[model samples]
Structures are given as C-alpha cells and as structure tokens.
Target chain A: MSRSRIAFVTGADRGLGLGITKRLLELGWDVFAGSYLADWPELTELSQKEPERLHVIPLDVASDESVQAASRAVEATSGRVDVLINNAGIATHYPRTIHEEQVEEELLQIYNVNAVGPMRMAQSFVPLLRAGAGKRMCFVSSEAGSINRSFRDNWYGYCMSKTALNRGVQCLFDELRPEGFTFRLYHPGWVRSYMSGELNTDGDLNADDAARMAVAYFLRNRYEDQGMQEEDRLVMRDWLGREWPW
Target chain B: MDQIVLITEAHHPWGRALVREFAQKGWRVMACSPVSVEMFQDAFDTDRIHIFTMDMRSRESVQQAVERIQEQTSRVDLLVCGTLSSQGKESAGIANMSADLVLEDYQANALGPIRVIEACLPLMDHGLRRIALLSDVQGSLGLGLSGAGTGYAMSKAALHMAYTMLHGDLGRKGFTFRLFEPGPEPETEVSAEAAAAYFTGSREDEERMVMLDWRGQEVPL
Candidate 1:
C-alpha cells in the first residue's frame, strides 16, 4: 500500500486552518498543523483522536525565526510535504476607511502576517513540497482583494494586503510552473471565522464545508497539466472552483 | 470661490504639472509631499498653491495634513494621489527581494492611497467628488508574466483594485473614481494636459470604474 500523503497547514488552531486540517486528516493524510499557540482545546482533542497521524507544531507566521524553526522541525520528522497550505493570517486591523489617518505601522503589521507570511512559508517549505508527490501550495485569500469585482470599501489593511498576497502568488506561479509546482489562491467564502468578526454573512458557508470543497478541488485538479495554460498561473479560485478576478 | 483640489506626491513632475494646471484654472490647489517648503515655492506660486509636508508612509503626518486641510475647507472637489515607492525600480526579481521590501512597496502604493482617500472622503461629500489615482499600465493583468519590477507592478495592480472598489461603493454617492495610467515614462507634459482636461470636464457616467490612458482613452480593466 502507498504511504499516507503528508500535508502542512498554518493557523491550524481554529477556523479555516483547523477545518482544512480536520478534512485532510479524515482523508487519511498525515497532517502537520502550525499554530502560534502550543495548546488549543480543539487541536488537543483532534491530536488525541489520531495521535500518530496528527502533529501540532508551534508557529508564528509573522516571525522569521519561528517560520524557520517550524520548517526545520517538519524537515526533521516528515522529510516531505505533499500539500503546503499558507492559511495563517490576521484581520485585527479593522475600521479601515478613507477618512482616517494613514495607519502606516498597523498596515505594515497586517501585511507582515497576511501577505509576507505566505511568501515566507512558501520559501521555507519548497524543498519539502518538491519532494512530495502533490506539488501544490495554496494561499487562503479573500474576494475583498479582487480589483475587478471588489465593491466593499473601508478594509484598507486587509484588502490591500490580500491583493499583495495574490500578486505575490502569481509571481511564484510564474517562476515555479516549469518546475512542476502548482500554486493556487483560494477565497474560502466568508465564514464565521475570528477574522471576519460577524460581517453581513447571512448565506456564507461554514469553515468545514469550505474546507471540504478545497480538498476536493485540489485533489481533482492539482495533477492536471494546469501549468501549460496561462490562466492557471494566476487564478484565485472559489471553493466551488470558480475563478475570482485578481 | 473656486473648488479645492488636493494632490499627493506633489514633488513629482506630473504632480507639479497637475498643481500648475489646477492653479492656472484658478482652483485652490493643495499639494502634499515629503519635499521641503522652499521646493514648493521654487516650482510654483505659493499664493496660488498650498503646500504641506506629508509622507504617505507615516500615519501621523498624513493625519496632520488631512486635519489641516479640513480646518481650511470643508470640501475637496478633486483628489489626485501620486505616491509610489521606488523600491520596485531598484529591486531585481520578485524572488530575490525580501517579503518585507515588497510589503513596503504595497504600503506606499496601495495602502497609502486608501488611507488618504478615506481621510478625504468627508471633505468631498458636498459636490461631484472626483478621485484620480495616478497608476501605471504595468499594473494591468494583460502584462502577466512579461513585466519586470514585480513589486511595483504588484502594488500598482493592488492600487488598481482599490480604485475599482472605491468606484463601485462611491459611484452612487456622486464619487467618480478613475485609474489614470500615464504610461511608464515620465513625459507628463501631454498626459498631464489631457488628464487636467478630463478632470475639469463634466462628470461622465461611463468614466466611472474606467481605466484611462493619458489621452483619455479607456484601457482594458
């Protein structure tokens, strides 16, 4: 029998990261969940359920030392990572509007966690991803970043940081497509995550459902020759697999 | 009394031309940049123009400037933002530049403008408020992987999206958001003239959410 595929997820303490981790584990993949906190009730419970298959690692996406240490720990134990999901992000900087003074420092802090965090993960985990069978790196982004369709304003920090994240993902795709690496940016659909903080989501899907769709979509489409097509190089797909404009 | 227009990054050639264009048209022009007071006086008439020391990267400085403007006048008819970092020009490939540097570029190009626009929105509630963001064609998705300066292109592209969002949200509120691509070069003489004309002309519904070249020709969104 083939060995279980290994996956690494950031911000796995709760929300979409936790959902993705649970879904991946249910699918029989050994999961390395990265979180800033060492212990969470949900994570502890999950790890207890599948002690051998699930491993929780301390990670802080905003810090270089933390990311590097996490990468080294993963390399030491797992040796290979099939799917690397850059899902760690923060939306704490709220009340973004045109009338407020430019909160440059706060915006930078958001950019560090939301945009640069993904880039850092990608760089640190590329070796493991290349060694695994599933060469996919996914970024959890949002529709607020879409320039063509974005209508809601006043999310100055989140919106711009996500846009930068999308652009960074595109650059990564362009540079790594030839090497059989597939990159995707997914808008997990508005969920009741800690990030959104109850913002007008009457019909939004829950985190688990969105996560199931993510895993299904990746499994179905990751192996196809998407690199040959120019469009796949820079697509921000919805959970249902529809492309969102960058 | 003439209407007021606030232009950020006023030290640039295009920004200077915009200042002169609005000033010549007898509009009250307030130009903000990190440059010194003597530079503003050297280039334009201090009597016709108001210059403020502002840096897009600092919240305190931007807030002070916006408050000062609010104190002077309650309305700003036209807002033109010309702030963009030179890091993209100095960097090599996207892979080589540290993520922090790229974030810096986004801060200046994308976040700075959003903050400025948000701050100036209240002052624009009375009339046909217009926002023209001076971006680049390099920001267009059509460029794809063919372009260099990945950081700049990416941030400018983010700026493009910001303007699009503003257009959608403010279109009904008498706000006209335009992405003004003045080409990659710095020859502002012709484009600035066309842009001034476009900005001064009657508000056209079709121009909302539109990306226009210096000649006022619509570019693909």
Candidate 2:
C-alpha cells in the first residue's frame, strides 16, 4: 500500500485510452495499462521509460476470463485501482444498417465488445476499485449514442451499442453512488482514432486533448472538496464539462 | 384503400390507446407488441387492426414484422414509436441498476425503435410522413433530472439522437420527426388531451420536428 494513486485504463495500446494512460503517468499516478494486443510498440517503449509507474497487462474486455486475470494481476502488483477507465470499444464502420442481413451479426459482435465489455470490466475490477480512496469508474462513450442530437444515420450497430453503454454507466452510478463511489461517462469528442477513420491529423480534439480533458475531470472529481451532488453522480458530459443528453 | 399507421410497443397503455384511436378513425393499424398478440386481437377490429409479437431488442423480430406489414401495405402514413422501458422505476438507485438490466432498457427504449424505423423506411416514403417518438422530459440533458433511473433517460436520449441523425436523409425524403413527452399522468385510456399532447404540440404543422412536451410546448434539448 504505497500511498500513490493508481489507475487502470483499458485500450491502452493506442488512441484516447493510450493518451489518458500517458497523461495519468505524467501526473505521477501509477497506471496499469490494459491492452488487448500484447505487442504495442508505444506502450512497450513507454513502460521501459517509467518501469515502476506504468505496467502493461493483457486484457480483453469482452472476455470474462481475461478481465478476471487482469484484475488479479493488478491486485497482486498494485493492490488497488483508484480510477478504472473502461475505454475499450469497437465501432463497425459505415454500411451497417438494419436493412442489411449481415447487420444482425454486426450488432451482436459490436454489442459484445462495446456495450457488454465495459460492464465486464466494471464488475471484474470492483474489488480493486473499492480498495482505493477514489473509487471512480470512467466510461469512454461517444456522441453517436446521443439520441437527442443525432445528426446522421446508417451506423445502427455503433449507435445502439454506445447507447447501451451509456445505460450501463447509469446502472453503475445507481449501484455505487450510495457507497460514495463516483462514475463518469465521457463522449470523447471525435478524436483521430482507428474507429473514426482519422488516424492522422486532428479530428476535432486529438487523442491528447481528449485524454487530458477526461483525466482532468477525473482528478477534479476525486480530489475536490466539492464532490458531485446526489443528482449529478451518473451524468454523461462532454470532455469540456458540459452535460450531454442521457 | 385506407391510410396505414404503424405503432411500436403496442403493449404499453399509450401505444394501445393510440392503436384503438387510429382504428376507430378508419386507418388500418399495424401494432407490434412485445407481449402476446392475443392481448390485442379481442379488443380491436381484426379487419383494420393487426397485432404482431415483436421485441425491440431483437432486430430479427422487428424485421420479420416489418416484412409482414409490407406485404399488406405499400406505404405507411404514420410511424409512432411508443417504446419505453418500465425498468427505470424498478431500479431507482444507482447501485441497484445492473448492467444487464440497463442493457435491457436500451434494447426496449432505443435499439428496438430504431430497428423498426429503419425497416419501415421504404414504406414510409409518402410525402408529409410523420414519425412521432414518445420521448420523455427525463431524457433532456438541459433538465438535469435524468440522474434518477439513468438507463431510461439515457435510452430515451439515445432514441432522440437516432431519429435526429435520420432527419438529414429522411427529412429530405419528406419524412418529418417529432419527439413527444407523455408526462406523468398515464391515460388509463386515451383522452383528447393525451392525443393532442402526444401528436401535436403548440403547432400542428408537419414541419415542426423539434422536441415537445405533453402539453405541446417545445422542450429545450
């Protein structure tokens, strides 16, 4: 039990999750990097630089066994998780529609990884989260789930799965708020990730900007004397702190 | 040839009332209920009202129903998505809300409706087509009251966005969208006020496609 704050971030190999892991490390928190792929060059190189702080582990959010093992590994090494970021998700690219016969398969596959995956992570890592001081669970959801401000159609699987993910966050908040545990659902505003087809230049907020905002909000929620009110516990907000539609 | 209206979540009180109303108005009604079809067959005229078993969470079921409806009618004048989750009141607290249960809410409130809408689109090309979504004040982020049963509110909010996204292409195709909040008072049976509030707000024009309260007032999204 070193008093150092600890964070476990999924999808740490690249994109917003990786960016958030890096930022948390820079902020002096010991981070457990959970990546699906074993050999992500960036995570490997970064761990070498801060061996004691960043520990990369294999985690498949969709797998009960994988998440359980990852939880055990984190418990053995760090003993606690102050903040758990459920950021691992997959978006089936364009051409997904209810009319397509293949969309039924796509919806199930995407739902398993995107909607059910985070819930698995949350359930598996609860012990570690409860062991720490700030028991905050952050879900990296998306605007595609926004039923109020929906601007496009055709990506039925991605949109519905994210919507389901949002509901799961609400459930987590309902279940944990009484225990003084906090939850955050962040719509990481369009970052250049593998999903959005913006792998290069900035897509609205780059991965770093999105990650910085998300981590900042998490720290503020954790350390501030003015904790969230009862009604504010399970809210979906943009990276900039503006409340988003359910 | 009578005009056709399709209603989802017909097991709901409001949805059932709407089906009866449309049936009486001489419009052929296609009602899809998550429960048994027997609940609907005895009440309404079988000649004008058709009921089918459909679950919003399952895309396959919705597709099947849509295909069945297409066999009878070439176009649908109205598509009322009245699907909503009753699970919110059951899981009042944050901790009590399980992931599986919340996912069920999403399936009922958002995913199922979207599937129905998309499947019914081809038959929805009639000019001035009205798509009414029975939404709620709880889903509005501006109200900040959605924290209670987060799943219900989140699912409604997701449904709102899904329709709005459809507006870009669908609107241009002469489809108009409306989000209606049914308020707290459940009409044990349909009333004039309930119909007025749910179908038309301050204005009756098909062009008004924003969110409206049960009283027909525009709700800030």
Candidate 3:
C-alpha cells in the first residue's frame, strides 16, 4: 500500500527463512525472498497468492556475484530496503574426531555457507540496508559461537564457522554502530530445519516453532538498542519465554 | 543453609582469589584442580574449603569428585566451574598451534566441564540448580579479534553453543545454566597487556579497541 516496507530474507524458499518471510508478509511488509532454488513449491504458492507483495529471487549466499546481483535487483524493484535477514546457512553432521584427519570436505562446505556466506551477504547488502527505514541486519547465529559455555567437543566446522561469523558480526557492530546501524546476532535454539533434521532427537523445537520465536524476537527488537551490549548479541529465549545462557 | 558446591580449576592464580571472595560471602567451597594438595593448604585452612585433586580431562576423576561431594552432601544447589587447561600461550597463534593441540584444547577447556556437569546433574537438586561456567570474552566468536589460538577459540565457541543447547533442553527441568565470560583477568598470566601485545598491531590500537560497559567503564566480561 504505502510503497510497502521492503524486506530481503536469504534462504527464504524453505524452513525458518520461509517462515520469517511469511510472518513479514502477514505484517504487511514487501518481501524479496531469496532462495537457492527458484522452483520451490512453497515459494511458487506464496508468489501466486500475493505476487504484488512477494518476489522470489534465485540467490546463493555463497556466491559474491549472486548476492550483489540479488541486492541490486531488490534495490531496483523496491527502491529501498527495510530489513536484511542473513538466514542462509549450512551445517553437516557433527564431526566425529577433533583431529583434521577426521574432518572431511563437507566440513569446509559448511564453513563456506554458514560463515563466509553471511559475510558476503552483509558486504553486498550494506548499501541497501543504509537506504532502509530501520537499517537493521539480523544474523541468524547460534549460542554455539560462544566460548564461555561450551561443554562438549566435535561439531568442528559448524562450531568454528559460526564462531567466526559471530566475531564478524561483532566487528560489524563496532564498525556500523557509529553509523546508526543495528546488527543483531541471534542464537535460534535448535530448530528442525533441512540443515538440522526433522526433530532435534535431543529435544529442540520444530521449524515452525523456532521461526515463530525468531520472528517475535525480531519484532521486539528496538532500534534504540544498538551496539555490543551483552543483551543485544547473546539473548536466548524460547517460545515459552524462558531465558537461556548465551 | 543452602549447599553450594563451587568447583574451580586449581592451576589459575585467580582460583585462590575467587575462592577467598566466595568464602568471605559464606559459601562452602569444593575446589578441584590438578595441582598438589600442599599448594592450597593455606587457602583451604582459612576459607574452610575442601580441596580435591581432580583431573577434569579424566571422567573417572570427575565422577570420583562428584561421588565424594555426594557422600558429604545430598544435593548441590549451585555448581560454579572455572576450569580451563588452555591459556593464551597455548592458544597463542593459529599458525603455531597444531590441530591436535587445538582438539586437546577443546577437550580440556570445553568438554571437560561438560563431563563434570553431566556427572553432577544427578546430584543436583530438582529446582534452582544454577550452573555457571566460567567463560572468556576471547572465546566469543562474535568478538574474537583474530584467528589465533585456533583450538582455544574453537573450544570456547563450541562450549557457548553447547550451553545454549543445554539451556534449551534443560529449561523445563528447572535448571538455570549461565555462561559467564568474565573478560580478561587484569593480574593473571594472560594479562590484558600481554593479550593486547599478542593480538594487536600496536598498544595504542589495542587500547582503542577495548570494550566499555554501559557506564562507559571497562568492565571485565
């Protein structure tokens, strides 16, 4: 209606990213859902229902060119961006051994997607973010990036990459906060996604539940609350409103 | 009197200080470390502390310590763990450290305490069993200055995630898990001066990069 609050969500064809896009649409925001695959059934269905509000773009966050092209297309289509959600990520089965001898190529792939992918997205979209209303960048991170609370081992690539991403986000906070940009690094409690199987087997939330909680968190995020405060980076809350350690 | 069992790593200089601080506040301390029994004799006597020789890397030692505590007390109200085997020197630079060293770092600094938590869970009271794990700001992936200390960094990062998962999984069970990054210890072997010199281009640059709290004061994490 009012030039629509344009939002760009990465990995939006499925899982939590798709859910985030759905919630944003319901809240009357124009969404440019970036998915690696263009022919996802859910994206097709959503696009058909509200073609005016939703635009599905083929985006591979791992590709620098793809991210740049996608950002340009969004800028051209919407003129300005409101929110940038770096939701695209990858995680493989936990590494079996602590040694590099045990780490396979798959681990490296996970690092590229989960860690470097977000960095690529952030680099490409900062301009569009600067052009937006709230000018906020939300990196869907995990508490796994924390060094203080680790209790187990293995999960080498995912742990290292996510940790690097978290540090990157923190550095970004240091750089961007002066410019009035809010970068929120979230630890979405083990959500059942393609990356993290159907059920947590270990008692984590389903995709829908995780998405709902994440959306709630994003909505509740205030613009005035910016920078590297502990509350900003490491707040962990579930659907039931329990605070967990970061 | 609520029974609180404070489990700390003996190798650190701050361990004695923290023990004294908690003891002054009237907590019954159960200090465990790989250090010799004679080393903590004075603190043990003055703080009314019980010192146990425990190797966190060994599950048997951890279980034994837990059993010893269980024999004396029925339930543990709080478990405050400050055990870290890897220091700044060990985790110094990514290029210098071997992958094996890195993994060992994870085991000692991260997984060791997890083993302790698992063993102690059964001994914990049903409600309000607050578990605080001592963490460092350096282990923070979001705030890490460099890729140095690959093993130490990875271990801390993994532990943070593990704690989050544990918090989510155990929230309904009435357990309160807290991951506290006490920032840099000012007067330790890994002093702020040493850390800055190792990680920064210059002392001035390092000084500029320091984080300030809400009060605009440098508060240790």
Candidate 4:
C-alpha cells in the first residue's frame, strides 16, 4: 500500500504515452501504463526497472472488455486513480481524403479510437477518479481539431475525429466539472509520434520534451478554469499553453 | 429545364417542408425517405416532387437513390441533406451515454450526409452546385451552453467539421455550401418555407462557408 499518487495512462507502450508514464514515475507517483503493443519492449524494460511502482497493463481502448479489465486490474493494485490520462489514439495508415475512392471504414475506425476511446475510458474510470484527491482527467488532443483554426484541406477523418474528441471531452467536463473534477485537454505540439504502427518523426518537437510539458500541465494546481465564472471552464490548451477555440 | 434539388430524410417535417417549398418554387424535388413514402404522399401532391428511398446510413441505399434520381433527371441543382437521429438526446453524460448511440448519431449526422453528397456530386457538375446541411447550435462551440449530450451534440460538431473540410476542399472548386440549424429558437428562427428560400437564394460566394439558423444569421464554427 504505497501512499504515492496513482495515474492510469493509455497507449503507454511508447511515444508520448510512455514518456508521460516515465515522467510520472520519476515524480514518485505509482503509474499503471496501458500497453497496446505486446511486442514493444520499452514498457516491459521500464516495468523491470520500477517493478513495484510501474504496473504494465494490457489495454485496447477501442474495446469495452479491455477497458473493463484494465479498470479491474487498477482497482486490485490501487483502489483509486488520482490521474487518468486518455492518450490512446490512432490515425489512418495514410492521410485520409474524401476524394479517396473508399475511406468510410477507415474513418469510423479513427473515430472509434481517437474520439470514442476517451469517452469509454472516462465512463469506466469515473468511480475511481471520484475517490482520488487529484481527480485530474487529462487528454492528449490535437490542433487539427480546432475548427476555427482549421488549416488543412485533406485528412478529413483524423481532423474530424479530433474535433469529435474535443466535444466528447466537453460533454464529460459539463457533467464532472461540477463534481470538482479538473480537466486538462492538451494539444501536444508537433511532436514526433507513433501512428499506424510507425514512428513518424516529421514533426519538429521531440516526443520526450513534449511529454515533459504535458506532465507539468497535467500536474498544474492553478488554472483559469478554477475561477468563479461559470462560462469560463473546460477549454483546450496547446503545448505552449495557448487556449484553443472549440 | 426545371432545376432539381435532392433532400434526404423526407419523413420529417423539415424535410417535407423543404420538399414542398422547392416544388412550389418550380424546382424539381427529389425527396428521399428511410421508409416507404406512402404515408406522406398526400402531403406532397405536386408532380414536380419525386419520392425515393434512401438510408444515408448505408452506402448502397445512397448510391441506389442517386441512380434513381439520375434516371429521372439529368442533373441535381441543389442537394439538401438532413441526417438527424432523434434517438438518445436524453443521454445525460458520457457515463450515461451508450457507444452505440454515439455511433448511430455519427452515422446519421456526419457520414450519411457525406455519402449522399458524394453520390450526387456527379450530377451537379453543370447545375447550381449548392450543398446545404442541417446542424444544431449546440454543435457550435461558441453558441452552445449545454455541452451535455455526448451523442447528438458531439455528432453535430463532427458534422460541422465535415462541412468545414468539405467547404475547404470543394468551395475552391466552385461548390457552394450552406449549413443550417432548425431548432427551438423563437426570435431569430425562420419558417420551414423560408428555409427553402434561404437554401435556393443566391448566396453562392465560394470564398467562405457560413451556417445560418433558419433566420440567415451566421453561426460560429
């Protein structure tokens, strides 16, 4: 029974998710890393290093059963979750376009993983979140979701799914914000990330550096949302801490 | 040659009104229903209105409806797609919300309209080339206060994003767009008939895409 704060992070096998997991562990918090890639050795290596504090979880955010099982596993080790980070997301194998002869199946799969996955995680973990002192529900979202700031013409599926993700998170905020649950919906700048089974390094920001900023924002105690104004809560902020238009 | 307008979800009052208004305005109306249009036949007595079955949820149904419309007319001047699922509006929160409900809403509210528009695009090459979609103010992040319903409102926001993408890509290619909200607003809401006037009106600037509540006011994306 460790007195350390506990966090459950999705897609924690590598990239930002793994980086967040590592940062949290360094902060002396007990973290359950949800590993989707079974063959990925980084998480297993980290678990070996910090065996007592880092609990590697087998999780598929797209499936309900996997999430439920992950929740059960967390409950057994840590009765409550102080922080729940919804960072499991998938993009199409290639940039999706409406002009593509067929993108329907690919689009729905993106929506299921990027948008609905977070909703499913929140639904399964709210009870545990309520019991924790931190009560932080953090999400790794993207600038692609910002409709007012939409810059691209192609890749409708990934961008729309992110927009949908923002709305779904807003729905959760509307309900749980009143119950004293603070949220941090973030757009981790252009960090090289893993997408469609490949590590894409085209983005300028390093994943590790982006992850450090993400962890700091996730642990931030004071925010504008904590103000008494009713209409001023639940905004999405980017890596540089600029608020995004929903 | 009379102009042609295809409207989906013709079973609803908004659908029926748009059909009648377009027909009365002398444009050929392609009214699509998810079910048999036998029940609403008397409501639309004009021969200018053509009734067909289309389930936007299914790609096959949308293609078949497009084929039927092609057989009846050479081109579609306007496409007014209304894909709204009235189920699960009471889905209180993310916990109370069902994934199936959100997916259903996504199918109807976002993907379905795109299906119909894509299927009908071939027929609009030489016509008005206007695409109108139904949306909700709740979907507008700037206007909506109740960010409560996970499915209905979220799906609408996704649809708004779809509109933005479509307009971004196609608006440059000479396709005009109008996003509409037909809801409970009293002061600024226009009549269902007036919705037809707005849809058929000459606001065909492809420079930007704007959403109007039946009243023709701009909604923030």
Best-matching candidate per DockQ: 4
List candidate 3 stretches off by more than 4 Å.
A196-203, A223-246, B1-221
Instruction: For all candidates, state DockQ relative to the true structure.
Output: 0.42, 0.26, 0.09, 0.63
lDDT of 3 by residue, B61-153 (tens): 887888887766677666767756566555343225443454466667666766677777777745347676666555554444454455565
**Candidate 4 clash pair list:** none
- Give residue B59's lDDT in candidate 3 (0 to 100): 74
Comparison by lDDT, 1 against 2, better one? 1
Best by TM-score: 4
lDDT tens readout by residue for model 4, B95-189: 67777677778888888988887788889888888899988877776665464468777788888988988888778778888898876534222
Name the 10 consecutive residues with the lowest summed lDDT in model 4 chain B. Answer: B183-192
lDDT of 3 by residue, A1-246 (tens): 257678888988777888888888888888889988676698889889988999988899767678779988887887677788888887765554332233335654665677667766777778887888878778887665554454435565576667656655654555566677776567777776766533245538766677777877775664433554443443434455554343
What TM-score, computed on C-alpha atoms, does each candidate reach? 0.87, 0.79, 0.53, 0.94
- The sequence of per-residue lDDT tens digits that candidate 2 reaches over residues A1-246 is 368999999989888888999999889999999988786688889999999889999988767788889999998987899999888878766554434443656665677678778877887888888899889888888877765556664786687677667765665665677777888788888787766333646478888888999888877743344663644556788877788775
Cα lDDT computed for each candidate against the true fold: 0.77, 0.73, 0.64, 0.83
The full ranking of all candidates by TM-score, starting with the best, is 4, 1, 2, 3
Query: What is the alpha-carbon lDDT of model 2 when measured against the actual structure?
Result: 0.73
**How do the residues B42-80 of candidate 2 rate in per-residue lDDT, one tens digit apiece?**
766558888878777787888888888878788888888
